[model samples]
Target: MKKIALLLFPFILFTFSTFAQSANEDWISLFDGESFDGWEAAENPETFSIEDGKIAVHGPRAHLFYMGAAENHDFDDFVFKADVMTTPGSNSGIFFHTQYQEEGWPAHGYEAQVNNSFDADPRRTASLYNVDDNTEVIFPDDEWFTMTIQVEGQHITIMVNDEVITDYTEPEDVDRGTNVLSSGTFALQGHDPDSKVYFKNIKVKPL
Candidate 1:
């Protein structure tokens, strides 16, 4: 019995160590907090700025794409999360399964709408844009809220402050030509000049 116990002890230790290492490796930060090191800004560069450990978006129309050095800044199945805060009447969004665009709105990927008291769009915070949109004003303006998104295969889930909000599944026959869902990098939106939003702790865990 003593010999059997000794052999099992080593095997258990090895298994635990391997699991912990993989979990840590799976998570990667898209933002470094001090600068836009692994990201690319399109259109107005002044729109995106780093202030007080947060990515502040407040100037004009622009989109910041994650161009990090991981898998060529491409992720297929992963969990994306960020701490976001919006001002009153502000509007913004986070895009997933998207690519870099030199000008105009990104033609690819899906937008997870970030809105609080904005009167223009009915879609509120933690919404999956047009697809399975969420209209509840879950978060208050000027306060930070944690938004979490999980995408695996055709399934997509969104949460606000750890509360499940949207659970959507893309149809198998969904068109792939236009706003259809596909694998790509992530992006942060600067909706307009008046809209002020802050984002931080942006990270992802590939599945």
Candidate 2:
């Protein structure tokens, strides 16, 4: 009986360890369904808000930001996934490695373009915006679309709804304006007036 109990103890310990690791490995939800506890606005708290279990970008021309101060969780190599929906002709973006600037847009960062309209320009959505990297069309506006960005070192790839869009590597010694590609905070853009955007299911895993 003593020998059998000793053997079972190891098995029980192993099972508990496995279960704990699995729970921690799961994706962390950035937004709580009830409140914006882990976020903040770029300029003012009035710009961004939580509405009906989703982060809503209101106003027509204000650049509202979701503050990421809880972890200061900067990533060097990781995979980011989010579900996004926007109004027609609305122009916004997902900014990464962004630094705050006073009274203007964040000068330092890269924007994952988010625009969806038949008349919308190619650079309007899913394009690397001024960085000159273009990907095939894979935007499903008027509904929810999954946007995934994978960054490994200097190489970055973006996929919209399982469709590969921008896949390019940063040129060595090239200037990235104010946008620091290696590491910084992540944010959602609120461009111009009347532009409403919704973001949900945002999760990130380190590479």
Candidate 3:
């Protein structure tokens, strides 16, 4: 019996290692930390900058789109997450299912509103914009939190620090083009000059 168990142990270890490797392959890192190597910024490139390994969003209105080398910078069913920190009165957002625009607010996709204490927008963090707004503030200002957005087909889920905040399913009669709920890339919003937000460890796992 002991000899048989020893023989099976090696096979079990190999199988477990192989499964772990496959799971890791399903995930991809979107940000390289030092610079915006695979990202594209709108109008003012200065609005998006890397500070101490975090993607700092400040300055005037602008959007940073992910134009990465894989999948043509587009994703359909995937789980995206980032570590975010907001200063007092800061406002920002994480936009998905959106296309790239030269200037102005992203006409395409849905924005997961990121605001803690900003006076302009009453909607706090984890609200799925107008689609499914959650007025309950789940994040704290001047602290780091994990913001996660997961999309599977017509369903969307937004979470803050592992807490589910918004779960929305797209309606059949939704609008088409640039504000539409369709397959597109991801983006980060720079609300205004007064707002300052930090994001790091941006990653995605295709479902």
Candidate 4:
């Protein structure tokens, strides 16, 4: 019996390793810390910068988007995540299923609110902007926290620090005005001149 068990051990270990590798491959990074090689900014490109291996936002309105050639910057059902840190009174957002424009707030896609202590906005991090707003303060500003967005079909889930903040299901007949839920790329918001936010480890797994 001992000899038989030893013979199967290698197969079991190899199976586990293979599963781990497959899982790791599902998540593809969209940002390179040193530069914006895979990303581009809207009008005011100067609002974005690289500091301490992170994308820093601290200027007038602008949006940094993933235009990488890897995925063609197009996505529909997917899981997106990033490590975010906001200074006091800062406001920002994570826009998914969105396209790029020369300027102005993205008229398409969904926005995950990233305001922690900004006095102007009550909807805190992981809130799906106006769709499903979240007001409870789960995390503080100036601290690194993980914000995740998962979209499967018409359902959407938003999480912060692994805590679910919003779970929404779009109705078939819902009206989105000019903003429509369709396949697109990802973007990071530089809300205003007063708001300062940082993002790192931006990655996505298309479903």
Candidate 5:
């Protein structure tokens, strides 16, 4: 009996160690280079199209989603990275902890904004969209930029082209008018008609 217990103890420890290692792996690709298999659109009625090995938002619609049925997955803390390109006045965002609904902007999740210049709105690019403030202009429209967002607990960090732009932690007990750093599905926002946004090399690492 003593020998059997010893063997089981090591087996349990090894199993847990392997699980921890898998959770910390760097950069799991969200976009499969061929399809939007694991992603979903958000509030906009706009359609997300795949062309030339890239996922793009095209055509006219409010908001659309490509999520798994019945909220099967959600992320609480993770590092998300994607390469995005947009037209001059194009506006889009990476929405986290997103709740899917019909016809309206997501009231639950947070948006890691995407914009170019100050063309559409001064708060256009890289802004936290009403939750926090955006001060720097780090996006160059029509040019590819690498955007990275790290969410750990209640703290969030936004980086563009490896440059730290927006770093904020949500205030505890403060009402941001929505859910705060809970957990839900991840989404890509397609804002308005005629707004074209392209996403590639999308990856995430859970913390």
Candidate 6:
């Protein structure tokens, strides 16, 4: 038993070291948890606020875009992640490959639906909104959950709680006008005044 433990110690240490190095080297936190230094809001700019050390989305229609120094807020292939919590009947979304719009819903990129129990929208959390809409409720409301969106080339994948929910591949002839897949920054949506959502640990890694 002592010999086996000694042999495994080196492997365990090496594994941990690799993980730490990879995370530090690749991932970048988009939110500072205390300020919006790297983020910019559109339309109802007041729709987002830092409360309890998390982004509080509690106002009318608005989109908050990432416009900081990281990659100049421009990403072609990357993984965007955040911890989110939605109140009952709330609606929100995370947009990737989207640019900042002065007003109204984002006109670019794709929306990974952050809705779990919103009675108004049939799309559930982690849905590739419209394009690959999901109606299954995979996670519950009022709880912290991790959502990740990975884009590589023409393929897009969305996960909730580290579980795959939506896997989309943009076709060669596919065209949805401004909503088509393209390289751009990320955005957070404040769906409506009635919906309240929380987001934290926002991060991304360019690939």
Which candidate tops lDDT?
A: 6
What is the per-residue lDDT of model 6 for residues 25-92, given as tens digits with 9 covering 90 to 100? 89998899899998899899899999989999999999899999999999999998899999999999
Better of 3 and 6 by TM-score: 3
Better of 2 and 3 by TM-score: 3
Worst 10 residues of 2 by lDDT: 62-71
Off by over 4 Å in 4: none
**lDDT tens digits, residue span 111-156, model 2:** 8888776245567567877785463445656798898887888888
Candidate 4 lDDT over 72-149, as tens digits, reads 999989999899999999999999889889999999889999998987888988889988999888888889999999
Candidate 5 minimal-lDDT segment of 10 residues: 62-71
- TM-scores for every predicted model: 0.89, 0.79, 0.94, 0.96, 0.79, 0.92
Name the runs in model 1 displaced over 4 angstroms: 1-22
lDDT of 4 at 32: 74
Candidate 1 lDDT over 92-166, as tens digits, reads 999999999987888898888899999889999878888788777888999999999999998998998889999
lDDT of each: 0.91, 0.71, 0.90, 0.91, 0.74, 0.92
Model 4 scores a TM of 0.96
Better structure of 4 and 6 per TM-score: 4
Instruction: For residue 62, give model 5's deviation from the true position in Å.
Output: 4.1
Model 3 C-alpha lDDT per residue in residues 33-62, reported as the tens digit of each score: 998998999988899989999999999999
> In candidate 3, which residue ranges exceed 4 Å CA deviation?
none
Query: What TM-score, to 2 decimals, does candidate 6 have?
Result: 0.92
